[model samples]
Target: MGAWGPGIFSDDLAADIRGDYRELLEDQVPDDEATGRILAAYRHLDSDEVHVLWLALAAVQASLGRLDDEIKARALSVIDRGEGLEPWQEAGPQGLARREAALSKLRTQLTGPQPARRQVRRPWRHVTDLQPGDLLARVASNGDTCLLRVARIDDQRVGAAPVIELLDWKGQALPKDRQLRRLRPRYRDDGPHRPMTYRVARLRKKDPDWHDAGFERVAQGLQQQGDDALPPWSYCGWSQLGDEVDRLVGPPKAAQ
Candidate 1:
């Protein structure tokens, strides 16, 4: 254990408090804000002391949020840290206990008559900037298919945990090193006001047909939307239940 300093609570109390905040950060409520707060919570610790923090942090960081893009980003980060082993198993149990305790307490505090958190509707934004490595999706409209990617995530679009999606990206399977002569942007519907969807017109792999092997693998990692927005998402599925709430509260109107 590190030396207990004056002014702060005893090392035990401080550790518990830090653990509480860390646990809270691991839960779904504060989602994005938790990253910065968790990093800041460790500010006082020396590098050596932070190793365990990083372990616990890395473990839960992957699944704590509902946003697929963010979850994938965090997973790739944590998995890259070489945590697929022993110490993780040892620390996992206690860490979950701490997480449970913290979130339970949060529910109590948040539900009190005077309550705490301000009412907010964080929703996921649409994805943009589709690339070779992204998972592609095709939605059906008017006998044509449109491609989409869950690209960006923010608190405003998805409250606490939100996701942003991008449409009009080519995610079709292409053979390695394939090149296309034309990129196709297709509309799902023939009628006016139809949202646009884009796909690669033709793919060639130094031969013929591009393979979407990589995208096919990543497709499982992405979250999908349905019957709601252009790219096909319900707030990126952060909470489909929020639909009724949104029904009660109308969407904001843009400036004319």
Candidate 2:
């Protein structure tokens, strides 16, 4: 995996496993079930990755006060065997020293008494019913209503969110069906042949007012050829939808 440092979680795979494990717990999955799911999810890992996975999971479990004997024993075994140090060894003596020290500290922590398990309340995750070709009307704070076309949907472990492209139509009133179908997606100006902008929007669970967010589905089943050629953008909070759309579309043109 990609590693930036010598810590146990310095590697991408380890860090991802830690996050996934904790998310499972937060979703009210029993510790054993969560551990089983994580293990099953990574069963494809080879020898080296297996070591990293077990160690990362064990460390996370310990910190969360849910460390079971099986996982702790497996992690300690990997550490004692120095099974996952191939990359560090290749990094030269200093790197190897740092990695070994980190492993040693992890071993000590694993063997120590862990704190009592903390209660985890299930979190409300953002859920979207939008699909490809669906059109949505987003009302901005300034009373400008923009049309956003759902180019695709990204369904991850967290939830589903739309990958949307802002259409070249914005007005005080939502557009008619004929107008929406004729509208082209706004493209970023700086690129050669200007590429259409795409962005993912997900409702923020922490935002108390997310339910009343100004998004409404207006139409569906509109598609254009070569839409799949557009580049993807990372997900943004629904609260930032208007600003992101404006940034992508640039300043509005002067009144014709």
Candidate 3:
């Protein structure tokens, strides 16, 4: 499945997955014994090998979704480690995000509803459609919202995902691999849930004049007071303002 023994993975671990699986295919080992040997091999894997082994296992599985829960659990265990990792591992938020993305892409490719049972899902437009300087509204996990501008778009392999760069109201760039989810038109409360399950829509195209009425009123006030400057505010206030704008005009049309 990976580099042979004494490298990132142990000899026993590699043998069980790469070798024992083959033995099972050849009828040299019973299914139960092969399963035991494979489970035992997991014990020999170090933190570094966890990811690789999981990926290798996924490669051999006919349906990645079958192992989706396990994959997330084991990947999180290694990527979210509290203790320090070897310097060579380059473990950090960015690295973790990239690895998570790889898993997401793999799962997307490997699993889906059967043709007869499938319903059309909301198609997520390509992030590359956003050009630099184009405005957007981003709603955070807490339901707070903020204005954003496209800062950059990074192209990867021909068929790989493109990284979208966004500049917040303060001009701070967010991590490229930060996960973005689509907001559904309706909602339901099904008990306790992870925050990731809830997503707010990302708005793109909008009428610049949508805020004109409010701005015009403010402008009149400023003229009467002979004050050209508006009240100072931090990003927190901007979030509320962004939310209001979204509510007033509705979500922007996504770029094609």
Candidate 4:
């Protein structure tokens, strides 16, 4: 049976899935051996397809007290970037989310109270119920002083909006938080080469009350210039905020 159903895959292909199954069962296979199994499984599957297998490997590694940076990294990537929802879509709806949860927990386990790059024990804030096209937050980026907007993928079951995407100032996609199960043992940085931040004062200059709005046309123009000409000002996924972000969680209901 295929991931979603029997129609998407053939019977023999299903049978071969078992061969990969045993490979997944072994807990303490040497690095070379574990890697080979992962590779073999990889040839026949995608990151999302082998999510469990990768998660298992990371767990086992932790059990054995082994710290294989590369293995951990790959596992984290799978967790962060999950399987797409529709057969036609590239990523599943909850893929990135799973990785995010996993990453948060993993860091605590690995570094105790102090994780690299990020501080430990930051208060967690999130949207309880998310819908597609619900604007998250504008993040800071690598460019001189520009920022980019970030949005989540649409949920198939929920009939959400599609993800309007763009490359950062570097022509690379924005950084993404991974969604692995055991982030501590197998966490990976799926975040892009750069993380985008809010433009703060400059943004205040435009109109303190209005942030995401009025920036669409400017973002579009910068995006059209491509990464090369981004000048640290390239925008990604910045669509109309006229009624979208406001209706969801904009200035009106925002807490002071």
Candidate 5:
């Protein structure tokens, strides 16, 4: 089994993440900025978007040579900002013990043998560069891989962002009018929206090695959105309920 740590990544990629954090430090962005941004995303985004953001950040942190402190801080911030309440928060000593026991059990489950993660490559940086037939990666709530094929680009002006039709690996178009949107410029005005900015990279894959019935389920879930429209995560994967809460409250591990 691969050791429990950050996955392998190119030096250039690792340097890029380091550079981004360094710039944030240089610019004097508050340490809570990352945490705050994550909280904002949790508040504004749907379940799938939340999963994608968490998974992507976990991947980046893993690639960063295991900067445990930085990763731990971000996770703790999410828990705190989300206003989580351990039983102890209200139940006193008894609740504290229960919470600790629950947490310990969860840690064991999370650290159990996990399936190998899909190996992904660098993706197109610009949305405009995407072309029909390109495959992108989407992560499910359980951290499974879902590959989406770009069918067409709809760059018309009428929405918050341009939409791209995507198909599953089995040649089935996602239900409804589901589409992928590039990170909008609006979020960049005050500062780079980490979730929005990194979404383009997070939602796409440079390789196509997935074939599973889960892809059909993914599409059907998006179709069920009706007039609501599917969030980018619909094209990607599902986020298991308790798993997400666990990660938000503690140091993140590879989604699992």
Candidate 6:
């Protein structure tokens, strides 16, 4: 696991463990079941990674006031035994000292009174009915409309969300199928070095902007042979839709 610091959550695996545990809790899984699922999920890890996982999960459970006795014992044992310190030892005495301090702090927290059990609210998961090749019209508040096409559906931890391609067409009315066929998809500068063709904007039911944004499905199942070859973009928020559309279609026209 990649670790940037000595803190419990500084490691990628530890952070992922925390997120996975909370996700299970948010889904209303029992504490024991969540713990079991997490352990089972990471059971293939080597001895060092297993120690890190146990410590991370136990710390998270303790903070949530749902710490199991067995988990706490396991974490404390790892701390006492100084397991999973090989990387820190390699980093030198300073790094090892910091890691040991972090472990000491965690041990104290685990042994102390935990906060009362907190309720984990289920997040509003975005589920899209749009399939690949479905055409959509995104109507801006100022009456301008931009066309977008669903390139693919990504099944994510929350739910299935559409990955869209912004077509290079903006007007007051939807264009003909033949007209759309000739229009190229817009590209955005991903960074200094890369330009991206697809935008993965997550549209959650709970997002107020999504409800207000005028979206209409105009066509469906229009997949072309090369549509599958488009590179995927990272997921973005629904709120970024207007700015992204503006970048391709220009800002919304002023109202009379």
Answer with 1 or 4, whichever has the higher lDDT.
Answer: 1
Worst 10 residues of 2 by lDDT: 203-212
Instruction: Give candidate 4 regions above 4 Å deviation.
Output: 1-29, 80-103, 110-256
lDDT of every model, 2 decimals? 0.36, 0.78, 0.35, 0.35, 0.35, 0.79
Query: Tens-digit lDDT track for model 3 on 5-113?
Result: 2132233443346444444434545444644565576767675565655544433332312233454354344444522234323555665455455545545544544
- TM-score, every prediction: 0.21, 0.72, 0.26, 0.25, 0.20, 0.76
lDDT of 4 by residue, 123-235 (tens): 22222132222223332222121223323333332122223332222212332333111111111135455322221111122332223433222221212123222222222
lDDT by residue for model 2 over 134-171, one digit each (tens)? 88787654456778888776666666666778777777
Higher-TM-score candidate among 1 and 2?
A: 2
Candidate 4: TM-score? 0.25
For model 5, how does the per-residue alpha-carbon lDDT over 90-153 read when each residue is reduced to its tens digit?
Answer: 5566655554454344333233443343333233332344443344444444444434433334
Output the lDDT of residue 184, model 1: 33
Better of 3 and 4 by TM-score: 3
Worst 10 residues of 5 by lDDT: 1-10
Off by over 4 Å in 6: 92-94, 129-131, 138-146, 169-174, 187-196, 202-221, 225-231, 249-256
Give Cα distance to truth, residue 132, candidate 6, Å: 4.0
What is the clash count for each candidate, in the order shown? 26, 0, 0, 23, 8, 0
Q: Enumerate residue pairs that collide in model 6.
A: none
Quick one: best TM-score, which candidate? 6
Sort every candidate by TM-score, greatest first. 6, 2, 3, 4, 1, 5
True lDDT of residue 144, candidate 2: 69
Highest lDDT: give the candidate number: 6
Off by over 4 Å in 5: 1-23, 26-89, 92-94, 98-128, 131-163, 166-233, 237-256
Task: Tell me the tens digit of each residue's lDDT in model 6 across 138-227.
Answer: 776556788888777777777676777777667787788788777667665455443244545455555633334556788887676666
